[model samples]
Every structure is written in C-alpha cells, then in structure tokens.
Target: MLERNEALKVIHERHSTRMFLETPVADEDVRAILDAANQAPSAHNQQSWRFIVLKGKYKEELADLVLSKAADFPKPSSTLLRLASRSIHSAPVIIAVANTGELIARGGDLFNIKDGSGVDFFRIMEIQSSAAAVQNLLLAATSLGLGTVWLGVLVLIKDDILKFIGEPKGEFMAVIPLGYPGQSSRGPKKKSLEAVIKYFVDE
Candidate 1:
C-alpha cells in the first residue's frame, strides 16, 4: 500500500517538463526505463517496439526533419507548431518509439483470423501496447527524478523519421524528449475522476 501510494505520487507529480536542463540523463536510468518499458504486454506477445535514442548531431538532424516536414502539413495552429519545433530541437536526448509494421501486418496469420478482416484488431492492440510502453517509461523517469515530455509532433513526420533512423521495417509511434529540468513544473491540472467515469449496470 505504501509503495503504491508512492508510485501514485510520482505519477501525479510528474510534469511535462518542456524547459529541460542542458544536462543529459544518465545512461543507467535510460536502461532502467527501457527495462520497465519492456515489461509492457503486447499483442500475442510480439513485443514489436524498437527505440532509437538520439543525441548530439543526430538529434539535431531529426529535429530539422521534423520542422521541415511540419511545413508540409496543414497548420491549424501556428502556436502549437512553434511549441513542437522547440520541443523537437531542445532536448538533451530524444527517444523515438517505433514498431515493426511487419509484425502488425502478420497479425491475421498469427492470431488465426480466417478472413483477415481482424488485422485492425491486432494493430489496435499493438498500438495500445506501445502506449503502455511509453507510460511505463515516463513513470520510470519520474521515479528517478528525471523529466520528460512526449513529442506528438513527430507523428506528423513519421515517414521522414523512420527513414532518418534507418528503420525500414518500423513505423514511428511517438517521440519523447528527456533531461533534467531547466525550469520546474507542477504537472497539468485534471478533471476529477467523477467527471470522467461512471458506473455501468443493468437498470
């Protein structure tokens, strides 16, 4: 019970941490985070996630790619784009999460669906697993007193990112930029649990 409370405290206290300190996250912590992430369950245990951790010039090159590709998309909000560009370029390290599309594609044969129409089912499960992985990683980082922010912007340039990372069989799912904080934050405000959840039952 105490450990669970401590874990929940870390989850609730973790902030988005955009203004990260220039200092790099330690290698051991990165390894631990990845170890925790690997514990996430996957569709049929395929475990399709592959992480590309970028630093120095490599991270910068990908940042350039992200910004350039952002111009190709329809900009519904220039402010959000500017924030994303900064997030892409500023981190001491960026961990790019990719999944084996081939594994997802083979789901029909692997999961024994006759018509193959259930490929979407497996794909969705894989994506959920990927999300679980990211959550585990972020929570681990928080527990280690490190900070991270998820870069949703990278999904806009998934093709370019996969090409840059040289993962031909991979599909980009998320980018996470990480470091110690240059500035502190108190995490995002949220609606109460009652606002979002309701009991369902036969009336």
Candidate 2:
C-alpha cells in the first residue's frame, strides 16, 4: 500500500498537461503505464478494454480529424484548438482505449452446460471498470513524473478514430494523450466537495 503522503502527492500533482517537451517517453515506461491499466478491475473479469498507441504522423492525423469535427459543431475556443494541437504535436504518445462490446459474455467448462447470461450487464460493467483502470493509469503516469490529459472530444469522431486505429466497429470509450509536461499546469477547476457530494442513510 502507498503511504498517505505518497498517495496524496500523486493526486495533487497529477494535472492535464497541454504542452509537452520534445523528448520521447521511454518504451519501458509506456509499458509500465499500460500494465498498470491492465491491473484495473473488470466485471466478471471480462477485461473488455482495448488500446491503440498512436505516435508520429498518426497523431497528427488524429488531431486534424478532431479539429475538422469540432469545426462542424458549435465553435469551440481557438485556444482550445491550439492547446490540442500543441498536445498532439509535442506529446510522445497517445493511447486510444476502446470497449469491445461483443466480447462480454459468460463462460463454462466443457462438461457443464450453463446458459450464458449477464452479457449486457457486463458491457456496462466494462465501461465502469475501464474508467477505473484509466484512472489508475493516469495516476501511475503522474507518479512516474509524466503528464496526461483525458479528451472526451474523440467520442464525436469515434467512428473515424476507430477506423484510423483499426479498431473494430462499436468498440471504444475514450482517448488519452500522455507525455512529459512542457508547461506546468494546475488541474481543472472543480466544485467544492460540499456542493458535489451527498450522503444517504438507510432506515
């Protein structure tokens, strides 16, 4: 178990770095982060999460895809686009995580006959489980002196990205860009704990 101070340090220091240095992240460190993600819990151990690691020209292509899609929708800030561009250009790695919808299922031994059930339930579970795993991956990166940013904008161009990454249709939840921080960043602003939390008691 991590000591309280060590855990808190990781949490407090973790930030969504938009600018990254030119240095490339070592392959071993990338493997370590992914391994940490694999350690995340899954529903019925289905482990439905899949990932595509993007770099070089592929990353630039993805950024263009995002920018084009964003233009088609409501006008977002120029600053946001610049930040996204900087992130993609400067970061050494980007991980695209997808959910394999069809893979969730029940299993049984050859000798025993058991009806398969809870596949749908397991799909939902995969989302929650994969999210937790992503969180772990982010924390692990921060602990190792790296930076990360979660981008939900990819969902808008999910189909394009899936095709770009060669992921099968209907499989992916989110994409996260990771690297060393070029510009120090404070995490996003958040509501106070009192405003966001509620407690319930059973009678």
Candidate 3:
C-alpha cells in the first residue's frame, strides 16, 4: 500500500482560519498560492477567476469600509458583515476574487447554440471555475503553513467592496484572508465517505 502523499496531507490539514498573528506573509508564498489558484480547471478553459491581493493600508481601508457599511444591513446580516470585517483586520493578507464577467460563449462560440439564450448557464460555469480556484488557493496556503479563511460574507456587500477596490468586473465571489495563525484549530466534523457517497453502476 502507498503511504499518504503530501497533497492528501495538505488537504486534510486545510481548515478555516479565522484568527491570525500580526506577522506579514512573505510575497513569494503569496505568489505561490495565487499560482496554484490560477491552475484550477474551468469550463471550456474560460479561466474566469480574477484575483486582487490586498495588503498594508489598502487592507485596513477595506476593513473600515466593511464595518461602516455593515450597519446599513439587517440584524444577522449586519452581524455576519462585522465578522467578515474583523477577519480582514486580523489577517496580514487578503485576496479578493471576482468572476470577470467573461464566460464560455461571450469570447467565442458555444456548442452550436449562438443566441445567448443560455447566458445564465454560462454564468454558473464561471462561478464554479472561480470556486475551484479558491479551493486550490486554500490547499496551497495550508501546504505553506499559512492560515486562511474563505470569507463568503464579503460577497454580501460586493458592490461597495468592489467599487472601493476599483475593480470593475462581473461579481464578487469570495475573499480569502490569510496569515500566520495565532491559535490552533480543531478540524470540524465531516460525514464519512460511505455515508455521503453512492455507487451508480449498471447491473
């Protein structure tokens, strides 16, 4: 039997890191993470993921914006927004992802259907591709011993956040805040493979 490989080890080590230390992440490590993300598969090779790395004063400014605008939202939403803002402030690096609005059919032809009637389907593919990239980024960060959390709450106020960062793109997918972890994390429970998986073989 083969031993557990480095890839599987990193995948198991990956978890949501909400708290972080004050130390800044190295630029080379950040580059490696982004490179991993860019290598993710996309539908028809659209490669629709766009990433914006935030640090220093820009990072602080974004946290402040999220906090200020969060009050305008409803109760639970406001609470979630505040949490996202706090995460941004705690991390040394934040990478924001957007869809870029470019899909399979726009730049070229689809599978013989050229009327743009199924634009919604193409949009979903773009979002899925971006999500795959984010997963790659998380795994890469874990391999480098960096802590990261995928901040989905950041998408709640996507427009203001995007405008603040001067990114004129499709839609905000997610933001990842990463740094050296300040505290340890216990892995969350997951369903067993046998419980979640099923075979669909023909008789």
Candidate 4:
C-alpha cells in the first residue's frame, strides 16, 4: 500500500493516455491493478464487477468487432466509433470491465423487489459499483507507472463486446487500454476547485 501523500500524488498524476509505447506492461502489475479493483465496495457487497483482459490478437479482434458493429450507426456516431476503435491499437493491453448481474438478484432479495419498479435503482447501484472498481484500477495503474484511459465509448457496443468476451449476461462498463505512454501529457484543463464546490451552514 502507498503512503497517504504518495497515493495523493498518484491520483493527481493520473490522466488519460491515448498514445502508448509498444512496451508491454508486466503481468504482476496487471494482477495488482485487478486486485485493487476487486477491493472496491459494492452495494450490499454484491461485488458484481467482472473483468476481461485482452492481449495480442484479442485486442485486434475486439477492435475489429467494435469497428464492424459501429458501422451500422448514423453519421457522427459512426465517425466517433471508428476513431475510438483505432485507439485500441495504441496499447498492448486492454481490460474490459462489466457488471456481472449479481447486483440485480441480490438487491431484489434484500429489498423484496419483484417488479421493474426497483430495478432501475439496482441497475444504478451496479453501475456505481463497477465505476468504483474502475477508478481503483486506474489509480493502481498510475501508481505502477503505467498509462491507461477509461474508454466508456466501448459500452455503445456493449452486448457485442460482452458476447465476444464470453460474458453474455454482464453489462459492459468500460474498456481500458493499458501500456507505457508513448507521449507525455499534462492533462486537460479543469474548472477550479472553488468553482465546482458549494457549502451550506447555519447563520
């Protein structure tokens, strides 16, 4: 585990990496990142996240799958999908995350939800839990000196991707391309902390 300040530094340094070196990430680092992801807390402790790690030909296959499926879409969307799929080749590894459908059944059992009325709430919980795990993954990669980008666009072809990866029952969360960065980045601009914060107090 990292010290408090070291952890903060890693969090601050993390940024989206779109161009990666051909260099391969170590197997140990990948395992560490996945382990970090597994530690995330889920609603009702469902821990519904599942990960599919891709390498070599699998990366190209997944990208090709996305490219082909995305072609059926209309103008700007197809264009966007094409561009996004191309980015997959920039990294040596891709990790696809999903919500494994455990949350729905468990939440239903806990809340006595037998209809669609509470399904949305459970779905949202699943997404939130998966997202937390992804954040942990990103941070873990950053701490290990590896680069990563959270590629949520892949979810547009979620069903196809899940089927390709043999997780037909899961809900796609994000696809992360990981490797050593081919280029340096300072990260994108952001609103000032003050601008995005609000506090309330009694007078």
> Candidate 1: where are CA atoms >4 Å away?
1-4, 77-79, 201-203
TM-score of each: 0.89, 0.82, 0.93, 0.93
For model 3, how does the per-residue alpha-carbon lDDT over 79-143 read when each residue is reduced to its tens digit?
Answer: 98898889999999999998887785473365555777667788888989999999999999999
Question: lDDT of each structure?
Answer: 0.79, 0.76, 0.88, 0.88
lDDT of 1 by residue, 46-78 (tens): 888888889889988877776666566676544
Clash pairs for candidate 2: 98-172, 99-172
Error of 4 at 25 (Å): 0.8
Q: For residues 81-184, could you state the per-residue lDDT of candidate 2 as single tens digits?
A: 54565577678899888887644544232213255555555567778878988888899999999998877666656787788888866566777888889888
lDDT (tens digit, per residue) of candidate 4 on 75-155: 777886776687687789999998888878677778888775888899999999999999999999999999998887777
Poorly placed runs, candidate 3 (over 4 Å): 1-3, 104-108
Better of 1 and 4 by lDDT: 4
Candidate 3 positional error at 9, Å: 0.7
Better of 2 and 3 by TM-score: 3
Candidate 2's displacement at residue 15, Å, is: 1.7
Off by over 4 Å in 4: 1-4
Clashes of each: 1, 2, 0, 0
